[model samples]
Target: MPGITSPPLPAPDLIDIHCHQLSGSDHRQILSRDVHELASHPIAALDRIEALLTNRRYLSLGMHPWFIKHQTIETAFLRLKSCTHHPKILAIGECGLDKCIDTPMSVQIEVFSRQVQLSEELGKPLIIHCVRAFAELLQLKKSLAPTQPWIMHGFTGKPALAAQLIQHDCYISFGKALLQTGSQATLALQAIPLEQLFLETDAAGVSIDTIYAAAAKIRGIDPINLRRQIHSNFINVFFND
Candidate 1:
């Protein structure tokens, strides 16, 4: 860890629109691959991450698909449902479809559909975790189309896909992959209207502050200015005010 620079000062009022902090699939995904490098204690990880959030405060919670097999839907929902009332648990998810997994698409759909309904009822924005099932996912959304907002976390499709999702009135979260030079994902992000765009580090182990800096570069704006715009993007998507 020596020689590693500390996280930059957080954006002045910037929101980390998507992140995973619960003891579920995404957590185990990170820990199992590199358990020694990942944060061991949830409380300390939150505090360490919050230390970078000088001008913002909020985090999302969820049990991702890879862990869904670890618990019954009822048990998983019961645990996740209870966390909604906690202060700082600003959103619910990083949850949704994953067609590539052995888990039946039916089970994924069931859990995802239930979460969407509950999100609507609880009035919390939902951060999604979609893979190759965009069409099916969109159909599901159109059915309920919750009054609450839904953000597609870690979006990496072509501009056409981005256009399709944005047209549905769902927000998108761009990440480090989009910051790569001359990549399709990078171009796709460049094509996203500033208003419809948000940023994330996903499971990449990169800091959002770094991701934001790279995003500013991609958008040809100062970090401070991008901070303001992304703040607006966050509010437009999640803020009821």
Candidate 2:
């Protein structure tokens, strides 16, 4: 043991609220990191749950509006409901309105509503994936008056939209888009409070570490402080323990 010493332990990092690398090619790499991530995928793919659990990471399940044609509403609802009680599945979604998609709005609404209801009934937060349908999403939120938290993932909307979401007590997550110079996401990130903010990589190639650093710069705060706040937010909204 002469002239030898063990390496110090690593510290924990920010929580990636939404990502798709759970069971994908990069799953092992993500697991080896110090950060935590909420793995998102279709409810139909419950078989992938095991991989997410292996690292004790977070999970968000939903029937994305873009892939509605793949299954009947009944089947999707059933699959989602089956996983609602899983201990590691902290949230329900990646589900929300998407105006640009070819799927009929009515059908999308129906599936989205059921998922929202499931989130409400199970007392879990939602990881939304809204796209050009903020109005409809807000309307649904108004109609439901849910108490559980709802986080909009991959938000690159205007600052006003970010303000509106915060006013409604909905959190907004900034992803790789925030790193783009002069982007709307950058503006919104500046306007959003540290409490209502989250950083994610989504399915993008960017790392959470980079996203957190960029977010910290946009808000003009220390990266460590930003990481601490988001980690607190994650526990406050998801763990509640």
- Write model 2 residue lDDT over 1-241, tens digit each, in one string: 5887888544345677888775333221211110012123443345554455555466666777767776666765665676668777778877888999899888888888887888888989988888888999999899989889999988999999999999999999988987799999999999878898887887888878888889988889977788778877877898784
TM accuracy, model 1: 0.78
- Candidate 2, residue 64: Cα displacement in angstroms equals 0.4
lDDT of 1 by residue, 16-128 (tens): 56654322221111111111111334454555544543224456666566667766667656656654554455566767889878899898888888878777777778888
Q: Candidate 1: deviation at residue 170, Å?
A: 1.2
TM-score (C-alpha) between model 2 and the true structure: 0.85
Q: How many residue pairs clash per model?
A: 0, 0
Model 1 misses residue 188 by how many Å? 1.2
Point out where model 1 deviates above 4 Å. Answer: 1-11, 20-55
